[model samples]
Target: MLKTAYTLLPALLGMFLLNGCDSSCCMDVPPASNNGLQAPTPVITLDGQPLQGNLTCDPTTNQTITLTAASSDPDGRVVENIWKVDGVESGSVVVCPAPGESKQICLIAVDNDNLENQTCVTLTANNTQPQEPQATPPLPVLTKGDVDGDGGGLYLQCDNTHDTDSLHLYPEDGPFLYGSNDPKDIKEITYNYTYYKADGTIESGPITTTQTEFNEANDQAPGICKKWFHTNNGVATIKVVMTALDDDRQTNTKTYIYNVADGLLVEQP
Candidate 1:
């Protein structure tokens, strides 16, 4: 009986050891720790301007503020970024105390993990006004030229200086020696003035002149004279010429060095 009892005890001990092993192997697993999650940093701005930057705002309206949060995890886990204003989950940006006589503003930002950052800004609106207009600029001085006179033969001379909006021509002195009523007797004369711009751009113009005429008489007139001047564009030279009908033939002639600007002639020396 003693031997049998010893053998039964050994079996019972073995069974107890197996049960302990099974209990440990089949135990329920404890839940994983979520404390490893990391929160992202938040970025903040005002009026589309960078933080710590110059920001302008109307003191009479609630200014809209923007906040952006970025986050990532090493486990490639997909996490939704959460936004908060002040302390609540009311989305990304917030407009505090609608604008009105207030010149100060505050903005805050938060990320998915509740990480946060904030900025404060001050704005001054309606503080100063614009000033009034001043006096107008002076008008430009103008001078005209006459290449021919009434009647038909060129024989006249006069000063044609005047203040005008643009270049003008006048028959300051006239009365041709031999006159003709035919329209062909009339000629269109041109006085050219050439100048240069600051950027080396050439500017030329038919500053002034008169119509044509026909004449078959001996006459020696000073013709037309030009005085080129510069106000805005660079210095330039003026060219003067006369045109008339002599015995039904086109007669044209020019004067050299008649008009000069800064001691320079219209034609290159």
Candidate 2:
């Protein structure tokens, strides 16, 4: 029996070695595996130049920029590449910030094994001159007339009768009017008249005047010799472009069009 047992021990040891088991234990263990997966590496480029770190751009010239990425994986294939601007995924087309602004740009490369790598850079827009506020156009008031050609604009009654009308254009005074919240004093006003003749010809002329003089003339009586539109031609279309300039050289211009029909002058939209 002892000889049989010794012979069986050597056979058991051989079985353990063949099954990849340690000599201390007789249980079978699988060999360690290495799939050799690797994370992707992303290389970012801005306008065909390699992006190493932060970048500064001019708002006037570099309003828009193109971003791209080249990604690779050592042991696997890169399946996707994503670009993000200001932490939002915005693809490759990046809208540069306004003057005195900054944005974050990032690139992410993903491998087939769900492994990813990211690279980011900061982009700042250079500061520029402070922009001036836009001037507001003047507002026009139209009132119906009591007599022939009497009211603010040309008055058209229920019978389509033509009458003198009053049309007054007021400069911007407050936010409720045509101007900004902070009202600016109007320094000058100019009127450019364009008459569209029925014969398909156009006549244009610039009427230059100061605001003080215009107010003195137009603001006299409610309807006496006001700055109203009138035509001696049978029927025509007239366009009056009124430009108002503030004290800071900011200007706002508006066009008022009037159409004459059946001897009645009517303002068009």
TM-score of each: 0.21, 0.39
Please write out the lDDT profile of model 2 over residues 103-127, one tens digit for every residue.
9888899999888889898888888
For candidate 1, the clash count comes to 8
Tens digits of per-residue lDDT for model 1 on 71-108? Answer: 33443432455444334456555453433322344334
- Give candidate 2's whole-model lDDT: 0.57
Q: Give the Cα error of residue 97 in candidate 2, in Å.
A: 1.8
Q: Report model 1's TM-score to 2 decimal places.
A: 0.21
Backbone steric clashes in candidate 2, count: 12
